[model samples]
Target: MADELIFYTHPQSRGRIARWALEEVGAAYETQVVEYGTTMKGEDYLGINPMGKVPAIVHKGRVVTECAAICAYLAEAFPEAGLAPTAEERADYYRWLFFAAGPVEQAVTNNFAKFEPSADQGRMFGYGNYDLAVDVLEKAVSAHPYIAGDRFTAADIYVGSAVGWGTMFGTLPKRDAFLDYFSRLSSREAYQRAGAKDDALAAELEAAKAPA
Candidate 1:
């Protein structure tokens, strides 16, 4: 179909974030599960995403990779879902959205890998340092009901996923602000539905690998 939205993801990867966003926007998309290191790196899949990453969406024949971009694109594409931000909310929406995608993601991954940069190196990095990046993120979440202000927007999908996975996986500190922020987001019906779908797919994959 000309308007088909094809979602490429792995149940165990950050694709969960994009899945949630898709559910939020109520987009009718077809899911394609890609395994790590095998089909994910294969020529066919790599042709879709040169980076060989999951959570990519091909909508209306246009490819959108990166969880943040997917969320933003879906929101705009499905305005009836009201996931897009208003003019007043635009500043915080883009600010915190990219902040999570850039600084927070970099800081958390570097911290998890135990690669602390020196002061000089920190200056060269966009995140500065994990501690600084995390501290700023905590304040951002606590300042408002949602990342983009009082209303829920696509920005929350990206930022909330970071906070949710970070705290759950021990990559981020179990701060009250982080926990509270994620708690609110996790309660959304869309989030629950998306999670259930992914969990089921994960179980199927595991079962297929089990000895018959």
Candidate 2:
């Protein structure tokens, strides 16, 4: 039970974010890729994540779920990684981390599904509206090199993935700020290593499914 983390993920899911965080932690980990509609929702996996979601991790037999939560948990679980925020930067760190997980995520999901909340219900929704949520995120990233400040932290990994994926998929606008931030985050060595492994896994899965 010495620093053993079992990572449950699918190559094409939000597991990507967890993978990046895992790399950053530099902890000994074993990844189990859950196949969609199969092991993903299997009893074994479901027991670990009742929601049957990928990107869940079991460290020392404790389960952690959700992309953002897993990333935050990993930072604390492996403090030597220096991914957690300093006491002085905790506010900014928690603020934007949850902001991205909630508002930014809501905006992107709504856009992708083409679902619009009634205009009158804007006040009821955390994001208010897609454009407003995006604008707020834009301003946040634009104002700071890293989400919590000049230093890179787990918050950046989580938010950076949102901005990176949103921009690539056109769910969120590709503003200059988002592009620059994503570029910087994507250039990190850990990010690249995680991405390569996931990309290879995705390609292998695709190949396996191809008609011979």
| TM-score, per-candidate, Cα-based | 0.97, 0.96
What tens-digit string does per-residue lDDT give for candidate 1 at 1-212? 42499999999999999999999988788999999989999999999999999979999888999999999999999999999999989999999999999998899999999999999999999889999999999999999999989988999999999999899889999999999999999999999999999999999999999998
lDDT of 2 by residue, 81-135 (tens): 9999999889999999999999888878887888888887777887889989999
Q: What are the Cα lDDT values of the candidates? A: 0.93, 0.92
RMSD of each: 1.2, 1.4
Q: Which residue pairs in model 2 clash with each other? A: none
Error of 2 at 31 (Å): 0.7
Query: Highest TM-score among the candidates is held by which one?
Result: 1
Candidate 2 differs from the real structure by a C-alpha RMSD in angstroms, to one decimal, of: 1.4
Deviation of model 1 at 134, angstroms: 0.7
